[model samples]
Target: MSHAPHSPLPVGHYAYDEVDRTFLKQRVAQFRDQVERRISGALTEEEFKPLRLMNGLYLQLHAYMLRVAIPYGILNSGQMRALAQIAQRYDRDYGHFTTRQNIQFNWIRLEDTPDILALLAHADMHAIQTSGNCIRNVTADQFAGAAADEVLDPRVHAEILRQWSTLHPEFTFLPRKFKIAISGSPQDRVAARFHDIGLMARNGENGRPVFEVYVGGGLGRTPIVGVKLRDDLPEEDLIAYLEAILRVYNEFGRRDNIYKARIKILVQALGVDEFRDRVNAEFVAMDRARYRLDEGIVAAIRARFGVPDFDPAGQAAEKLAQQRKADRAFDFWVRTNTHAHKQPGYVSVTISCKPAGGIPGDVTSSQMNLLADLADQLSFGELRITHLQNVVLGHVRQDKLYGLWQTLEQNGLGTANVGFITDIVACPGLDYCALANARSIPIAQKLSERFASPDLQREIGPMRLNISGCINACGHHHAGHIGILGVDKRGEEAFQITLGGAADQDTVSIGQIIGAAMSEDETVDAIARIIDTYLARRTAGEQFIETCRRLGTAPFKDAAYATA
Candidate 1:
């Protein structure tokens, strides 16, 4: 069957040129042939496995899984609608949004993936490099262009990196999977410091956009915060500098042991200074002009991301105030789920996918359609998927928020608990994943149900609670303020708790294990006890992390290990 070309350009973001379209079409055709060969027994399972994985097809516990890359987490209404259609037509009528800012269809058939990929190509999307030992999807701040405090739009740079890393010959089959994240704002919602490489935008001496580069930060069996490789790097040299770092890692990273294959382990073994020196030496030997980025290319990419038509003098404060006065729930949602926008009278809206007793990031096909409609009506036909497994409508007018919230509430999408305890991050553990040691959704559900009260969550203040089913740390448990890692002990599910971890831009830290493992039932009580201890010992205005720091883990340890 011939694969016909769809639209050459994406709906709202950067338009894909002919080269991009040709690449995706050719990739799909090649994978289709691979699938046919595997099914026909011309290729062995061992041989086909790597090819399938390289194309984002996975053999799960029951069936095959397909992960579609949402580059930079940016999505338009057309793309969202296409995803909804895929969920409805191909698999179950739901898709799980992952912490890596991608979506996974758990029940995808091996025979259906090529067709699914063909559908995605129509939206200028793909699944390339989403799996296997290659550079995965490049993630960035969901609020990249819209945030009020952003120094620059990180998506421009993120898109550049995505193009550079796509099917890169040297790094395609690395020691292990690599991840990179970029953030434009000082407040890092993307958790950049927990990736293999992190880039934060900053203003240089000449007021041009520079980057604060960090290397060797990752989470899995070993969790480490990245060290600053350079305080300031010129924008033109970004690709070359990154090439240097990846080259050093590709050369020296451990290949014998799977667990020690990550770049973080190498950085730790060699020391950050030594690693930096090697990268600098390699960079010095390279031809700078050959790798240097042209300003015109940057300008062309920037042009594709057209500015939103915002009303500068629009008056919406009075309407918002009146709505807040009339409805307390609306007021609470506005306070928790909405954020300041770069444009006046506009705000970014975070729609909490995690409801009480619900799975963390699973959104139904109906909800997806609703989101697409809402995006078209209120959010400039654009939306973003966050690394925290939440959906964001980045350019909603303040006056339209109440109506949007009302519709969301009617459809069970408005939970009014962004950044709250109920807003938990979880992975598809034993329920769907083959790699999981235990179930994570149940634990997340229990926690959300226990802390269902908005008043209680607000009183407790901003806290991050992450759950991982195994040591792979897909849920980012190590970076959470309260990290819960599920493990298999003698074929029984047990949980280990860690405290004082953070993934913030200003204070990135890894949580320390508090004590022995607890049963799932006991784990819930332990968390309650820890929270009670924090409440009892906290000073005025102290958050959970601050209270923990002031009183230390001794108090929490005692509380957690008490009679229960």
Candidate 2:
């Protein structure tokens, strides 16, 4: 069952054909002209802002940032190398991966952006809809086609949604930005419940994917779990149903206030039941037949994704166990980093971008190329970007796992604290983002150093500690089990703690404010104390979230303010 190294066919299902390549070239040419116009003083900054934004270019505090879309977080090694090339040539020698499973080049220049887009075109990638008020890049489970618990592959429908929403004349200018997440796995890996439209898709009796839709779910100043708008919706009707929701939100949604423009606000104002009624009304009246997903189209899209060849009886479970007994570090890595795959011999590996003291999702240009090469050698030339600011080799075999680990360690990519306390998700914060009120990276660095012990991290078990620089919740603090939100207090940076939020299928909830804002030092101390308190109180090996759910925030709050 031995496979050739870097085979001609990649395990990644989606391959861009002539049509997709043509579309990218055309888009790049258009952006190239726009960049020239802006450079030559023909287009004012104000005039060029929207055009640039439509292509995922942003004016950050220091410089222009370009966000390249990794649609559904799916891209191959070739695409990864393309990103590395962009980083090496156009901007800084590094790129920061975002919470949305996209990469951001923080030091981008306006003049070089057109060239960058043109280069991206060669790799069959683009930055379209990565910004603007449109339905932004659609995200699904990182282990979409491979998770052992998957009900059905959600990416087919994710790609379907991408096609349906991209430049759709109606949704191009909505009340505000909209986000949608889909999960085929019952375990919910992609944080489906926290999106604008969250869909939980399962296999139907007819083998077609059926979706349970959740609308108005978002986090920010107002963090709320989206409510289920519809149940058991056939795949064919998905686009139609979503269009209905968009139509309702676009028409009656608030146009006056920037803060109140999200679909969550609209859902709140109208109430969930009323909002559902409106969507249902639109669904019944619209041209449902025209919007229905055609079987031919679905088949074509699915065909683009080539299924990887897997060894049916090639698992080296005994060999892995023996190797685990030999090397403690490798064993520890295997314990936390690898996840179950649907294939017999393969396991999905999460490459921790969160080195103990390094930035959470920042990957160097060289590291990107190394990962690209590694993806080719071991993971069928495919890589997945996790929403938690990490990368995944979705189809790694159990036998070659040790070699992969060694190479990753040599290259400074082998931190094994995935899902542990040290794997904190944080935004760029005041360091790079103008919208940030406080420094998030420093706080994350402090926490990572404080809980650097592998034994301590294992003892704490799976923890979700998220930090946001402001009320915007870009770091998804509201969805973290132990959330720290930076707030302004008398011209000084302070943090507020929230407890008991969960972002999975088991329990979807927004974390509650446990206590008042505290200084940076106090915030880290509070998190440590909270973890220590959980160890004392948790009867079994219950995770931080489970403990938070069972024991309530009362105890954690006490520990947080125990000294204060």
Candidate 3:
């Protein structure tokens, strides 16, 4: 079948040229043959493993999981519907959104892989560079173009990196997997500091986008914050600076140990000064024009993501106050789930995927379909996937929020917890991932159930909780306000807790270990006790992290181990 897009796509997404379409079509055809070869035993499993992985297919504990890159987590309605269709037709009726802003179908079949790729291609999407030891997805702020405090929209830069890194010949097989996250806003919504290369966009003297480059930050076995390499690198030098960093890492990064393969290890060994010097030297020696990101090219790409024609008077706000007074639930939902938008009379609505008893970040096909419709109707035909594993309708009129929330509530999509305690971030753990030593989903589920009360969650206030099944830190436990790391103890799962970690740009930090490992039940109980202690000790308007900061982890630690 022709792999070309069967229908014209929505205009809100980053525009792809004819070359991109051709590349995707060719890749699908190549992978279709590879799948056929593997099935017929013409290729050994080991031989086919790399090929399958390069296409973003993985063999998990239960079934094959396909990780599809929503490049920078921006999705148009057509792309959203295509994902829903894939979930319904090729795999199970559900898909899971991951921390890196990719979507994974945990039940994809080997035989149906190519057809799924074909379906994705039909919507101008593909799964390339979603996996592998190469530079993975270039994640950016979900509210890049919409946030009120944004200094420079990171979407253009993110798209630049996306194009530059795809199948990059020199860096395809690095010492280990790499991640790069960029944020346009000063708020750092994308957790830029915890990524391999965190690019924080700022305005230059001339008021164009410059970057504050951070190198060697990652959260795995050795969780480390990236050190600032450049405070004010110009926009044209962005690509060149990144290339220099990668070249330095490619040469000096360790290959002897998988545990020490990340650039963080190299940076730690060399010290920040030495690493910075090497990267700068490399940058100076390289042919400058070969890697210069031209302004014309940048502008051309930015135009592809055309500006939204927001209504001057979005016919908004006049009815919102009345609706909030009419329905208390709507008010609560609005308080947490809605965010400030740059445009007047509009807001970005965060649709929480973490229901009281449901798995965090998992969405049903029906829900995806409805969200696609909602995106088309209320959010200007575009949707965004947040790093916290929630969906954002980034451009909704304030007047439409009540009706949108009502529709979401009827469909079980309105969980009313955006960043609350119940909105947990968790890896699939032993239930899905083969590398997991423990289960993260069940723990998250129990915690969500325990703190299921919206009233209780609101009382607790803005909290960041994360769980990792292993030290890989895919769930980013190290950067959470309250972090839980699951490990293998003697023959069973044991979880350890950490407190006072933060992920935002203002107060980014790694959590400190609170105590030794405990059973899943003990872990849940410990969390409850910690929360109870905070409730008793906190002053009015004190958030959880604020309480932890003022009193340190001593009281919370004592409370956690009181039962032991």
Candidate 4:
């Protein structure tokens, strides 16, 4: 089938065109046929596994898991409602938001997948490229375009990458799964340094967009920080440059051992200089014209990203200040859950999915409906899924903040914890994932319950605690300031701790292992002891990470293993 003409873009959002729609329909049909063959004994389990995986379906320990991609973490009310419908009808009554800006339904059946995919297609979304050794979802800063400090919207280029990498013939089956992340702001909210490829957009000396490209970063098994390959690549060279990097990787990346298959291993094998030199040679030899993006095409894509019309006369600061004065809870919510917006009188509100003693990234069907309604009425019908496993209404008027907070509070969505320690990023460990060695959610719950007090959390200040069930690093434990990795020691659950890791502010560092693994009970106490060490050692203004960096792991180690 030929490509379809572009349709009109949705107001303040991007909508899939006829071509996109046709593509999804065709893919769903293809998967549906494959499913029939497998069920009829025409194909064996081993033979059909890869086929099912390419369409984002996985056979976990309990049931089939379907991971639906939320490109760049952007969603509208209609799409959100569709997800709610899928959660209610197909799987459980809730969906799990992942750290990769996608949602996975754990109880999916293979028979229901084709229908579910059809439903998603109607909403202009899909589960394609979400699994199986290819470029995964292209993630960007959750606050892209809305943040006050962004140089430009990273989604613009992220979308470009998404389009270019989707089922590209050359990259259909890489040695390992590949991921790419982009950031437009100075702060690295997307954990750019932990992806296979990281791109940071900035203004060049000539006042044009340039990217600082980093390659060979990954977290699974062996975590390594990405190294910069290009300091200032022009906007037009994005595809060509990316093609060069991938070509080099496709040729040299290891395939002999599954553990050493990631591009990071190859990059390490041939130092950064050698890798860069190889990529440069490839770039020099390629037909640049074939990949160079035209200004018209760029502008067309940019136009699809409709900007929200701000109320020019809306003055919300005074009203918000008055609301804060009257209500302490509202005040706390404002301070903790809201972020500064580029547009005056507006703010980006983080709807905390991480309530104390709850599943880290789950939202019920009713909660999803309520959030969709709130987004439509108060947030220009736009919502974003954060990489930190939360939801964001990126365009709420500050004047409506009080009412919005009240509604969210009523629905148990108004937890005043965004950057706090309790705002954890956890993978569906032994509870859902078959690859998991130990449980992650229960540990997160115990930790949150231990430090449920808002006062204590505030005093503790901004902290990131990520938990991964295994070294696969789905929970991004390697990027957290305090990272927890669940391991299996002698067939028993044990948790390993790492300290001083960071993913933001261009200060990317892999965490250092503190000590030997501990049992589930000992793990929580060890965390508390670590906190106590930080509390006792911290200066007046030092954060947990700062204290750890200053004192190294000596004090925390001594405290964690000390006998009472």
Q: What would the TM-scores of all predictions be?
A: 0.97, 0.97, 0.97, 0.97
Stretches of candidate 4 off by over 4 Å are 1-8
**What does candidate 2's lDDT look like per residue over 1-564, in tens digits?**
233254444566477779889988999889899899999999999999999999999999999999999989989999999999988988789999888989999999888898889899899899999998899989888888889988878888888898889999989988899999888866788788799999897777787668889888899988888888877899889899999999999999898998999999999999999999999999999999998888887888877787776655454777787888999999999989999988887799999999888888999999999998888787888999989999999988888889889999998899989998889899999888889899999999999999988889888888888999999999999888888898889999999999987787477889999978999999999988999999999977677788788889999999999996
Better of 2 and 3 by lDDT: 3
lDDT against the true structure, each candidate: 0.89, 0.88, 0.89, 0.89
**Model 3 lDDT tens row, 367-427:** 9999988887887788999888999998888888898998999998898988889889988
Per-residue accuracy of model 4 over 1-564 as CA lDDT, tens digit each: 111122245434566789999999999899999999998999999999999889889999899999999999999889999999999999889999998899999999888989999999999999989998899999988888899989878888888999999999999999999999999875778877788999988889998878889888989889999998897998889999999999998998888999999999999999999999999999999999999988987878888877676665266888899999999988988999999999898889999998889999999989999888887787777889988999999887788888888888889899999999999999999998899999999999999899889999988999999999999988989888899999999999999999889988557788888889998889889989889889988999998888988999889988988852
lDDT of 3: 0.89
RMSD of each: 3.7, 1.7, 3.3, 3.8
Candidate 3, residue 534: how far the Cα is off, in Å:
1.0
- Give the residue spans of candidate 3 off by over 4 A: 1-11
Task: Single out the weakest 10-residue window by summed lDDT for candidate 4.
Answer: 1-10
Q: Which whole-number lDDT from 0 to 100 does residue 226 have in model 2?
A: 87
The sequence of per-residue lDDT tens digits that candidate 1 reaches over residues 154-218 is: 88888999989998999998999999999987677778788899988888888887888888999
- Superposition error at 441 for model 2 (Å): 0.5
Q: Pick the winner on TM-score between candidates 3 and 4.
A: 4
Any residue pairs clashing in model 1, and if so which?
none
Preferred candidate (lDDT higher): 1 or 3:
3
